[model samples]
Target: MTPAPALTLARRQALINRTDMAGPGRLRLVNAAGQSLVSIELDQPCGTVDATGVALTDTEFAQVTTTGEVAGALLEDAAGERLATFTAGLASTIPAPELPLPAAQLYAGAFVRLIGAHIVCD
Candidate 1:
């Protein structure tokens, strides 16, 4: 067996480009059972790829529609097609370098805000 080669920054950027080709994207916060908590519209072009990976644009506040513990996130195209999924949690609990939420506990009608988040590729 052979080990797979790690992706270079350029390669990572290329992958991101393809995923974001549809322009503008959405980040849907979901619970362990895969129920959506809230869906926030991302900026057109979504983010810029660089050494730090995909630097997501800050998003406007969106109201949470369901109450549950946020377990992960679904990245989707503007049309709601899934692009990727990533582990999610409170800023101090998530193992990933980015994709932090203000709190893991969410309730309907509560506003969720996303800021300084990124799709880090390593």
Candidate 2:
């Protein structure tokens, strides 16, 4: 049997993009009640810069929520190992802004290429 691929630190924000949120799709799984959830749309691609890059549009607000259950799900097991048991935390926008141009562009495209609107979980 093929070994299961090891999960890695993946950047997949496009999965939570606005367009995706606005359409019919899988309901985010939940393990708690009354948690906070937030999503943000940037005026320019906050993660991508350059002619080939994508900037977030300001027309929408970058959402922030107290609910972090969904965010917790996206994190790889290894990535979440350092976090405390509590799941309350804000998911930051794409990290590409903190990276160099080439890295940023690649990450930006990854962030925006999701089938629907992309969002950072918090």
Candidate 3:
């Protein structure tokens, strides 16, 4: 597993958690090889790092559960370009909010990507 990167850009801390619709919604980044990356269980408006900069699918959201996984290509968007990392037998333990409360959910076989702070190019 890779280490947590330091927040360097202003947008790093500015990233807000995004939530998908309860019934159906887009997962964002998709793998061209046609494989499920991760799956996140959301019951309420769970905050997520949404890079698409698009509108939320549904404002009505819920909290994440331990049984869920965030499936999809975790990407790092830097300088307007999205980056992909190798997940070959690798698992990352992201710093989740906390236990015993409304927080993010993660499980085995979950896929994730790391994004940098800067969205602009030098």
Candidate 4:
């Protein structure tokens, strides 16, 4: 089998930097049906990019608009253009993961917070 191509630290930083340039992005938590349950505006400048990738700034609690089990996450730029999609899971299940919610089940009218979200280019 062919080995997968690897990216240098500089290359990874460059890619993340480009995405961060779209600053003030949005993080959307969605259900299995692809319906948004909560939408939070990321910090201006979004995050810091380094050899490891981007470590997103913590987000304020955003009210849940819909109730369901979180199945995935979507990252969008300031203009609402999608930048990436991530698999959602509990924190105990993954490493340097995305969408690691405290609970899988969220209800409308409740608030959710996103903390320590990191994105890697690998």
Residue 87 error, candidate 1, Å:
0.3
Q: Is candidate 1 or candidate 4 better by TM-score?
A: 1
| Alpha-carbon deviation at 101 in model 3, angstroms | 22
Query: By TM-score, highest first, what's the ranking?
Result: 1, 4, 3, 2
What tens digits encode model 3's per-residue C-alpha lDDT throughout 1-122? 53234433223334322222222222222233434444222222323333322221232323222334333333323222223322222133343211111222344443433222111110
How do the predictions measure up, each by TM-score?
0.79, 0.20, 0.22, 0.76
Each candidate structure's count of clashing pairs: 0, 24, 19, 0
Total backbone clashes of candidate 4, pairs 3 or more residues apart or in separate chains: 0
Can you tell me which runs of candidate 3 are displaced by over 4 Å?
1-9, 18-32, 42-122
What overall lDDT, based on C-alpha atoms, would model 4 receive against the true structure?
A: 0.74
- lDDT by residue for model 1 (7-110), tens: 56666666556556777678898998999999988876677777756777788898999999999888887667887788888777726534666778899999
Q: lDDT value for candidate 2?
A: 0.26
TM-score leader:
1
- Determine the C-alpha RMSD for candidate 4 after optimal superposition of all C-alphas: 3.4
Which stretches of model 1 miss by more than 4 angstroms?
A: 1-7
lDDT of each: 0.76, 0.26, 0.28, 0.74
For model 4, name the residue pairs that clash: none
Once all C-alphas are superposed, what RMSD does model 3 give against the true structure?
12.0
Model 3 shows how many backbone clashes?
19
